[model samples]
Target chain A: MKAVKVILVLFLLSILVIGQSYAGTIKIGAVLAVTGPASFLGAPEAKTLEMLVAEANSKGGIKGNKLELIVKDTGGNPEKAISFAKQLIEEDKVFAIVGPSTSGETMKIKNIAEEAKTILLSCAAAEVIVNPMAKYVFKTPQNDSFAVIKIFEQMKKMGISKVGVVSSNTGFGKAGKEQIEKLAKDHGITILLSEVYDKAASDLTAEVTKLKANNVQAVINWSIEPAQAIVLKNAKQIGLNVPMFQSHGFGNIGYVKAAGPAAEGVIFPAGRLLVAETLADNNPQKGVLLQYKKDYEAKFKEEVSTFGGHGYDAFIILKAAIEKAGADKEKVRDAIEGIKNLVGTAGIFNFSDKDHNGLDINAFEMLTVKDGKFIVLK
Target chain B: MNTQLFFQYFVAGVTYGAIYAIVAIGFNIIYNTTGIINFAQGEFVMLGAMTAVTLNNFIPLPVAIILAVIITIIIGALIEILFIRWLVSPSVLRMIIITIGLSIVIREVALHIWGDGIYALPYFTGTALKTLSVGGVFISPQILWVLGICSITVIILNLYFKYTLMGRKMRACASNRSAARLCGINAKNMVTLSFMLSAGIGAIAGCIVSPITYVQYDSGTPLAIKGFTVAIFGGLGNSMAAVVAGLILGILESFSIWLMPTAFKDVISISILLFILFVKPSGIFGNKEALNLKEF
Candidate 1:
């Protein structure tokens, strides 16, 4: 009985030592849509964050403190994101949080993160996530408005005045459509027609046919679903023959392969990651872009997408801030805001008190698919 | 509307209609034999397309498609044997819930196997950009293939039901299960055959339409809903009515975009479904007297 009592005391003493050691480590929480509909975005984001954290630990702990990553899979549900956010803040007491991969989820947890005074680096692309200027929240993806402006700038360069817009009824598509409509007049462009189609539509020929009938100078399709590829094919099939512009959501090369020959000459705005191989040696983002592309593709055995790059930017920004401020929550938050010209896979981020997204319209490079591969459009 | 624009809409409607009709026919084949609706019917289609896409990596496209259909048929039989056969006259609601659960399992399994990537089979004859222009109207060659193959499947199914011994026996089970068994026909085996038949046809439709409509892991659910709508619109168990109803729904959906936003396209079709169910529960082609005699 005395020996058993001694063993219990020893076990309890070891738990205290382990708990004390854990307090010295920095805990980073992530709420990602690791499964379900948004898994395409969150899966890559999760994998990238896991990869980067592993690499950081392997190269001696960051500032002599090991990192503990706690990823909560919200499965793209906003309610789940809220609960996960609270849990990460209160229970986990993480130093900072990253992701909630979709815009809706990010928006839902925005206030929770702010109220808790925890730093949040969002991976979603919606402009609203940063435009209202929450003190503690920052987003990594380039603004939807910026992507719209880049497309319109390309359209102006081509002297295309009137264009028809077709977007899927997804949040991404709706946000892009709203940006396109709101910015069209400013760009000296006339919107001939704007149509919203179902995201799961099996055939878009009728929608494309309407666009053809409108006799628009160009066509813009904003969507991230397989339906976008269908739009491309339908436009080609119905002989629309006009230049087609897509949103930054067209970053995945799988869409191009799915569209086959129809993908040729399709233009969209995206980060430099897709065309990193062609970027100039002196380009600020070229090295970061290439390294991430190489590392992610090598580790995951899949084509690197901009979605993953958004997660990469979020982690890199957080890491740089933590390194600079030594894990003090307020100092890390200020350091993140003060960050300037930080090269990332997405763009050279320059955060400030006023601008949280840290990306300009120039962050998007006009890219076009050619011969079933992405290339920078001249 | 201009003749060219009208024809374009017509062609688009027919292409979608063909696939919906095939899916509806798949529903009918099993519904006729077993009172229970197999919610996994759509998964059979997805499985066929996904299997063929994976198989095409190793073998020729034609061979891949054939093997995919056969494999899906076997899967259908196994599903019936494993899940449904032992149940002793299970309630329709219970059976439906079970099938729905089965569909979720299959979809989750598919998600794990395929990951979250969109895949499509190459066009049978030409590239995605290839189209045949007639006067001022354009039509994809794959659309022609879709229409042709779907029509052949329907006709072949009709002939099989009319001429084949197994088909007649299955029909006997459909009309009177106990009487069919008394006449030395194995009603349970007939039910299994019905599942195989439905899965085989669903697989064929999936392979033919996959080039036009890309297949993802969750693609089956939407197709299943649309197919269910078409099946009800035509009548529960009448395959011929499904063809006509499917085309009508497709054309209405395609043309609905002309008057309203394209987002309301599904709304238009589904409203029509509700209208039919409220007014004529027997469906457009279904005889009211015959429907009254049959148990739902």
Candidate 2:
């Protein structure tokens, strides 16, 4: 009886302490695919968001109001996520929204966020998620166009002239094609052959052999997971090994492990800022990002990959907006749009009235798999 | 277009084709002997590769592979006796569902035990990059192993089916279960034998290719589908045709990608399957003069 009373007293006291820290509570909603095929991303994203929120609350909360995280599962479906976003804004009345991963899914709810005048901080890497001028959408991930352009830059340095590109016929892949086409003339690179594979399509041999026949010097892949590995193996089997490259999304341990020996020498453009020890001295988002990296590694029990770091930055950006606007949805929207030189894990966010990505072209980092890990060469 | 690279691609394609052919042969054996399809055949590959990883910690690669095959064969037989026997019926849909369910259970169990991380099995010689040059094309040792192991399997299987009494019983069971049973043959044991053969063949494939592609918890589905596709393309139960079809498909796929973009490669393979369905209708070596020639 005595022990029970003592334990009850401690629990009550802790709750009181927690309550006192967040006297002005701010509700922040996050949507991710917590279950299903893409749960790998959702599981990690949810954990990271909760940790950041807890840390912020412990440190007197964000601007004296504790961040309340309301997370829901989308199961990696885009249509279902639009409903989740609507409910989060209307029923939950969250001041800011965090995620619902992948560009394809994010694009589904972009218009909804805009109509509701909700500030949606998307972590998906599709360029169009922030394009076509959505006032409320700001992306934390590097759009596929930027990633492909980075690859093209590296290809120029390698003296590559012509390349065949294979992209998933999804929102992100289309964006990559747009970027690659725009840069073709500048780099003196010609698009020899282009092929589109649906997400569920497997056994990609005929298309790969066709690319080889077209006399393409290089192959660029813009997809994720087992499919990417399949492409590499098929290309190698057909003797089309002219220094193949992939997008940043393919830089996970899953791709490397599945590709086995095929993964060697495959180059791709990953967000290199995550790999650097620190951003430059004048880099706006350096200090917060360094602290984020330290705290994330300590909490997650894993290395701070770009995904986790992206989550951390997105959280910070949302928190800063809420603090500036006193958790008012309309004011938060204005603050996010008007931001200038706000330091983040990826790079400085210099969002203006016209450009919402806030990225510097200098932030590009080209990488290749070396001994079963991504090594940034550019 | 180059002679050496063409040779390289040819050898590599045939080598991969051999692996798929053996997997298809295993599928055909179980399907023909028993009136069921084991979608979990890929899990046998996962099991074999994972077993090699564990055994290779203590034993040599060859010993590990042999042990993996033996254990998988036993497991294959046990699963048939315990689960598949009860589930087998005249309803084809039910059998397919049961096999799919078994595959899920096997996959989840493997994932629970091993987690989702990919494991790299060491190559037999620890020399994956060192290639055998013929003319101008380079061939890796993995290709050679896939070819040599598959050839040995085909020869042994040919001999077993042609000369051995047990093999004759298996063929009898496969051709007609009721007739084989009425003729005093133990159809149940023959069914078990088919599973044993399949699991062992799949294990062999896993052992040969694990050092090349490695293995993960969910690596079974695509391999199963490819093997199934190959089996279907060959006339379902025809082992020789399956091998030939696998090689043809592999080579055609490898060379066909040279004419299209690499992304649309899957569509091309699927299109060929559709084309075969329309033109040949009964597959490459299908049994003729039969009204309803069911394929596994």
Candidate 3:
């Protein structure tokens, strides 16, 4: 009994000491869709954050204080995201948070971040996250508006005036549709046909047939996953000769393989990370992009996607802020807003008081599938 | 509508209908023997497709397909014996809940094994078949494959139920379990056989449709729902009705995209199912006795 009592006391004392030491570290939390339907986005995001955080720690962390990263898997559920955000803020009391991979989940946690005054550097690309100018929230991925602008500009250059828009009924697809509808006319493009499809739809033949009948010069498919590949297959099978443009959601090479031969010549707007190796010698984003591409590919054994790049930017920007202003959440937020000309994997980020995403149309590169590989579109 | 566009929609409908028809047939085979809807019927299709895609990396396409179907049948039998058989006179509700549980387990296991990425099986021909245009309308060879397999499956099932003694015994078990057991038929074996048969059919459907849609861990639920709708709308246990109903549902969905917004495809599907239930509670060809008996 005496020995057991002494062991219990030693254990309690060690726990107290360890806990006190841990409190000295700067805590950053993350809510990512790591295991659900959107795992494709979240998995890479989680990996990038983990790797960057480890590297930061190895370099003696922020201001010689170890950075503690608390990552919660939201599983792409909005309720779970909200709860995770709340837990990160109220329980973990992290100085900052990063990611809630999808637009819908980010939206669910936006208010919580503002209320808690915690810096939320989200990985989602929805314009709504930063449009209303939440005091504490920002994002890393290029917005749907930028993608739409790039696509429209490409269309004009290609001398294509008429286009069909096919969007999935998901938040990402709907958000892209809204931007496309808003920007089409300004670019002198006609919206010949706009169709929405079930995200799980196995076929888009009927919709593509209608687009063909309408004589659209190009087709813009705004969605991800099995639907994206299925649409391409259906379009190819029906012999629809028009150029096919996809959303940045097509950044994953799995999509190109799934679409098979149909993927060839399909163009989409994506960040510079996709063709990092091919960037010009003096390009601002080239060095950071190549390093991240190399590190991520070497570690994960898969090609780096813009989704992962978003996570890398989040950590890179957060690291810079922490280094500048220490671990104070308010100071970190201000430091982030004041960041300028920070070349990242995504773009040359120029955050300001008014703009949160800090990426413009220049951040996007129009890429096309050639021989089942991504090539930079000229 | 122009004839070309009309034909395009027709082909789309037929191709989709072929998948739904196979799912419905799987439902019918299980329902006829067990008197319970196997919610995992869709997962069988998913497993079949996923297995074939995974195996194709090592084996020839035809051999991969055969292996996939056979593996699916073994899984089906195991599910019946390991899980469903242990129930002590399971209520229909219990059986349904059990199958739903089974589906969740299988889907999660698939997720761990395959990861979240969507996978596609190579086309049987190794490369895409060029569209064969009739006048202005176009059809891919894969669609033809889907149609051919569907027709062959329906014909085979029809022949089996009518001419085979084992098939009749299974139907006998479905209609009156105690009576069939009294007649010296092993009702339990019949149930296991039906599950294996249904799984084989479902696997075939998955393998064929995969080239068009691609398959992922989560693909099973939607396929299951669509198949369930087709089965119910066609009269639960009647295989012939299931095929016709599946085709109708597919065609209606195909045209609905042109007639209304694309988001309404799922809405139209559920709405039509609800409307059918309200108008014809026995389904289009539902046997009044069987339908009423299963209600409990």
- Once fitted onto the true fold, the runs of candidate 1 whose alpha carbons sit more than 4 angstroms away are A2-21
In model 3, the Cα lDDT at residue B261 comes to 73
Say which docking band candidate 2 falls in. acceptable
Give all TM-scores, in the order shown.
0.97, 0.83, 0.96
Question: How well is each residue in A1-378 modelled by candidate 3, as lDDT tens digits?
Answer: 999999999999999879856745988899999888898889899999999889888988878989888899998999999988998888878888999999999999899999888999999998899999998999998888889999999988999999999999888888899999998889999998899888888878888888888898999999986788888888878888889999998988888888878899999999888888777999888889888988988998987888888899999999888889986778989999999998887788999999999988898999999988888997
**Best-to-worst DockQ order:** 1, 3, 2
Model 1: per-residue lDDT, tens digit, B199-234? Answer: 998888889889999999888888988999999999
Q: What is candidate 1's CA lDDT for residue A96? A: 90
lDDT: the better of candidates 1 and 3 = 1
Query: Weakest 10 consecutive residues, lDDT, candidate 3 chain B?
Result: B122-131
DockQ of each two-chain model? 0.87, 0.30, 0.73
lDDT of 3 by residue, B1-296 (tens): 87778878988887778778878889989988888899999899999999999999999999999999999999999999999887777889999999999999999899889987788787765455377788878887787788788888988988898799998999898888999999999988998999999999989999998987789998988888998999989998878888899899999998887788778888988998998899987778787776887643
Top-lDDT structure, candidate number: 1
Q: What C-alpha lDDT does candidate 2 achieve relative to the native structure? A: 0.74
Off-target runs (Cα >4 Å) in candidate 3 are A1-18, A21-23
